[model samples]
Structures are given as structure tokens and as C-alpha cells.
Target: MNSRFRRRSLLNSSEDNDPMSVVSNLFDVAMVFAVALMVALVSRYNMTEMFSQEDFTMVKNPGKENMEIITKEGEKISRYTPSGNKDSSSGKGKRVGVAYELENGDIIYVPE
Candidate 1:
């Protein structure tokens, strides 16, 4: 046999019928799949953060005396403070109402 043919035959015989070669190729394919999945997940997370509605909506800032006041309907924002109290306390001092908490995790408050 020619030297070139002999060399090719020798090199090919080492791996041609080896089960380890198939396993190595499978492992390489699995690694590629895992890498692709990670890349996709990262891209999806970035896209969710970019397109989320929280970006468009305004967050309520810390207002007078721990009051969680928000005005949604009015274009021009207005703040109204009930006379005498300034610490913005809740409970019976919270609103113009008597609040009752029910057994089903619901709150019912009636204005005074």
C-alpha cells in the first residue's frame, strides 16, 4: 500500500468505529444546546425589563408625613391635608371612616 493510503487508514481506524467518538460528539452537541438556551434566557430577561409597563408608569414619591397619596385621574396634581393632623397616621385617624377587617381578608370602612 502507498504510504499516504497507509497513514490515512491508520488515522481513520483509531476513531472510525469507536463508541467514545460518538459520545464525545454528543457531548459537544449538548454543550452547544446548553449555551444557546442560556443566551436565549438572558435575552428574554433583558427584553422583559426593557418593555415592561413599569417604565411608562410614574411611581408615587414620598410625600408629606408618610402619606401614600396618588392622583390618577387629574392631569394637574393636587395635595389636600386634613386639618390638625400632619403625621399622616392610619387606623381611625387614617381616613374619614371606621374600618372593620373581616374574616375573609377584606376591609370595610364607613365614612363618619
Candidate 2:
């Protein structure tokens, strides 16, 4: 009598058909998916940090050259002079007041 005949697998007819191989293959697939997910998360995080503009400053005034007004939020608003004073619809006079509108619809004007 052979030992192979005496020993039998509960689910398979022969030792060659061991179910552990299937379990190992599943584990390998799961590991690969886990690694892929981790890499994707890291890449997404890096991309978000690269292109995000939340930390950048904004320019408030585009046409002005000599004067720059930096807001509380770090935005730089600029005002410039035309070498010769030309009268236009836009006031050429000095800034008389600076005002900010609040969320409650109230305007707060800074004393000049």
C-alpha cells in the first residue's frame, strides 16, 4: 500500500491540486492592488500640492505702476502714473477712501 493512497485531501482528489495555490494567488493579486492604490494616492497628493493656487498671492490692480496696495489677505493692488496727466473718466486724483464690504452687507471704509 502506498502512503499517497492512504492520505487524501478533503476537497481535491490529489495533492497536486492543493487549494493553497489559489489562496496564494489571491493574496498576490490583493497585494498588487494595495500597492497600486498607495501609489495613486501618493501621486494625487503630489499633484494637488503642485498645481494648487490657494497659497499664491493675487494682483488687485493691473494698470498702476508706482503705487501698490497690499490687502490683509496678501493681495497686491497697484496704481501707476501716466508721465503726463491726461483727464479721463477714471479719476486721476489721489485715493480718497478704501472700503471693504463685509459678509453681512456692511461696508467698512478705512479712514484716509
What TM-score, computed on C-alpha atoms, does each candidate reach? 0.33, 0.29
Clashing pairs in 1: none
What's the CA error at residue 82 for candidate 2, in Å?
46
* Candidate 2 local lDDT, 4-40, one digit each (tens): 6556444456666787988998999999999999879
- Model 2 alpha-carbon drift over 4 Å, by segment: 1-16, 47-112
lDDT of each: 0.63, 0.61
Candidate 1, 25-67: lDDT as tens digits = 9999999999999879879755333333342222334454544
Off by over 4 Å in 1: 1-12, 47-112
State the number of backbone clashes in model 2: 3
Identify the leading candidate in terms of lDDT. Answer: 1
